[model samples]
Target: MTAMSTVPWLTILGLIPLVGALFVAFVPGSAETAKRMALGFSLVTLVIGIIAATQFDVSSSAQFQLGEQHSWIPQFGVSYALGVDGIALVLILMALVLTPICLLAAWHDVPEEVGPRGGQRAKTYFALLLVLETFMVGVFAATDVFLFYVFFEAMLIPVYFLIGRFGGARRQYAAMKFLLFSLAGGLVMLVAVIALYLQGPGGTDGFLIERLTGLSIDPTTERLLFVGFFLAFAVKAPMVPFHTWLPDAATESTPATATLLVGVLDKVGTFGMIRFCLQLFPEASQWATPVVVVLAVISVIYGALLAIGQTDMMRLISYTSVSHFGFIVLGIFAFTSVGQGGSTLYMVNHGFSTAALFLFAAMLVRRHNSNSKRIGDYGGWQRVTPALAGIFLVAGLSGLALPGLSSFVSEFLVLVGSFSTQPVATVIATSGIILAALYILLMFNRVMTGPKPEELVAEGVTVDEGWRKSSGGTTVRDLTTRDKLVAAPLIAAFVVLGFLPNIALNFINPAVDKTLSYVQQAIPSLNPAGTAAEGSSK
Candidate 1:
């Protein structure tokens, strides 16, 4: 809105990493140089993200801040538009912060391998990571519907290779399944996108979200289009029936890949539900709430239960994400400011918690030389790695939403908001909190506190021979300087957000207010006094 917008903050924030990826790809130096270059670029982007966040005027009446729009394709109504509300801003910031941390976490992930053509494996890995960062930032920032879909589809390319190329043995199968599910959802969305454009004003900037915000359509048509978009998000949110691809993808991908997959990218689903499904089709959103709420509750309970039964640590963490995402979706459809705001905050909180768990778990597995993912393979680690154990415990506690942690606040807000409308479903979803405690503590007890694997095998227990042999004697190394570096920011985030949720909520609540006003859904608890006054007048 101002000449200051000439800076194109969001575009540069996304482009810096994109350009870094290209540079890394062509670097003639060793793998170490590529890694450092990638990390430095990620940090610079983070600095830009923080600057943009500071530039935002929370007091402004505008729904989006730091706006930047330029026409891209005139005839098709597509434009190089970018903007962010409070929700998108926090998500972008989360992605930015996590990128550098993930780089640090993955510093040694790739071993320099020689190819006949002389391509560096590490270069490819780091470049893919930076490319993924660009798409992640753009996906959250795009205000043009067409631009959003472009970033959404483009995201799949780097992720598929990241998993299929550098991940575990079954990586190809997992990658293909993830691609298939995502592509199927994307195709449905493509239909909806085209239908939406056809129904719009059909001009140079017709696909701008602001332009399409309140377009009138017949009930049947609106409902049909809403279904197309919602189906895509549900698969991405990965609510129950469509969520089959996640466990496979998470289990097979490297920790860094899984961190971004569940933490940042998956959020695009719930974000789309808010940005498009509810914003563009308010009536349909209200019409579909009952079913969506039911599906959300199902995701909550089902994911937790599956997590409890998992043997592999990565798969367990993945299922826990499925459960956490359910809570987020539940809050969004609840339609109260408190619920929607909580959902947004939960997205940020869960990203940090899940990333910590996955990265830390991988580090422990690698250090112990167990080369196994079975929870049964790890035992009595409290003595061997006390500092790492303690840090991992904090991450676990955050996952379960223990009181005084950041996640507890968001989870609490979500439940309170949902209870005011869909009390029964909210109550049923509350069981997930109980199940969360079971999985986290039980997993800690089994994987961190019990007898060693060799001792268990000595007592006539069945265990993997490799894990038993690899479980070294007492006094294994603890968290390293780099490990501490990777964790410090995340841990500090938990502490800050735990005690001062308003740091995020202040930015979030204003945008939530605007969204609720735009959607015009009837949420009973949102204004009980006003509703009473209206009834008296009637």
Candidate 2:
């Protein structure tokens, strides 16, 4: 174990945004000042994250590296432990990469309809964003189960305000829905954590995840505990029936908030399943495999169908996340190394592609204030806003798992690996690939091709006009230099990861293998080294 005092960098990294949050909260008021402070603070955290990423020893034998641990509550056996295996490390990096971009993208998105409190409103908004960043980072870095839970619950405050204060017409309703759902999930999991703590050896406090993993529980007890955790995790994963809040929340919040919520924050749910569920409750996971896979396939197909039916751009993209998350869940329960690895890879790729897509949608909506989210309202946009259109095209194609993109690799690996274990579910999920293509192509055709709508015509939503000329009147301006700066990195990430995924896969594969290793003792058929990849119809 690494000394807590020697190199507590991950703790410092987590604190950077937290300190920034406190600073922004008291910094008087001014939109310009708020923006600068927010960007500056988030950048500091990003630097910390980058250093953490670079310092990580990929070739090391340890599953989790650069650890920092200190006893917090000796009686409870809880500690302030923080570390990242390959999986959590990548997510921390992703959150870092996206945070600043979201701040920059929201620069002009928040209107002055906020009244005299507008200045304070902007400052509060930025403060919440900063706080959210800290929790997001903390959740990924936490090595202790209790620490993970703290970060998990702490994240809701900023997001609640982000939606309630800064979102669309029904922001209040959306915010409450999000709050209730999250609170319910948390309450259920709290009980399970208590049970795990009580089951500690000699009742000596065993809240440490690594220690808890070694304890054996009866199959019935395991299933009960698993359900407690899985219900909370599944709702957060927003798998199938529990996913209703997502589309509404995404559509109402600003694009930047939506990007973080859908792209990085949502990944925590899937991450938890990977880290806690499959790792801690192996036998119960095996017993529940058939049911979980069925739900996963339903999420994939149901989300795709919902996405195809949505007219709102943000809502449409939100449904796509629901669908993508389904694939991740499916891969995890498939109980193969390939499936786990693919699920991890899916997290990274989806973060990039979905961030790009949401940002693009934000750009489009900003230009045309008309709530016309319908397909017919956005014909021939490629003619005037080619850069924006092009980015959207890349995002949309990636969303559908286009070949040579980051998603294609993960989705392919997931389906192939899952076939041997859950062949029927795998086959059904493959059809989702085709369905993804359908929805994405339809989205592209509706917004990019055909005759430009009269509203867009008036808004100067032309494909050929660059931002420099301002051809679409004052209302429909082209992509600003800031917009390019924000989106370029995300787009580049998608392309780069698509071709050289080993940069990420190398990190994910080991962590995924560790997770599978923990589970295979109870589920013997899940050995990854010998699994065949042929798609089975049985």
C-alpha lDDT score of every prediction, in listed order: 0.87, 0.81
Model 1 vs. true fold: TM: 0.93
lDDT of 1 by residue, 1-538 (tens): 2122657899999899999999888868878888999999999999989988998877888878788888899989999989888889999999999999999998877765776534488889999999999999999999999999999999999999999999999999999999999999999999999899999888999888888888888889999999999999988888897899999999999889999999999999999999999889888888899999999999999999999999999999999999999999999998877888889999999999999999888877765554679998788877566787899999999999998889999999899877878899999999999999999999989878965534322222233211234253422456667788889988998889989998998888877777776677433233423323322221
Pairs that clash in candidate 1? none
Q: For residue 408, what is the lDDT in candidate 2?
A: 93
Task: Please give, for residues 7-58, the per-residue lDDT of candidate 2 as tens digits.
Answer: 7778887788878877777867677787898899889888877886788876
Please name the candidate that would achieve the greatest lDDT relative to the true structure: 1
TM-scores for all predictions = 0.93, 0.93
Error of 2 at 471 (Å): 12
Which sections of candidate 2 miss by over 4 Å?
Answer: 1-5, 113-118, 202-205, 454-475, 528-538
Q: Where does candidate 1 have its weakest 10-residue lDDT segment? A: 457-466
Collision count for each candidate, in order: 0, 10
- Let me know the TM-score candidate 2 reaches against the reference structure: 0.93
The total of clashing pairs for model 1 equals 0
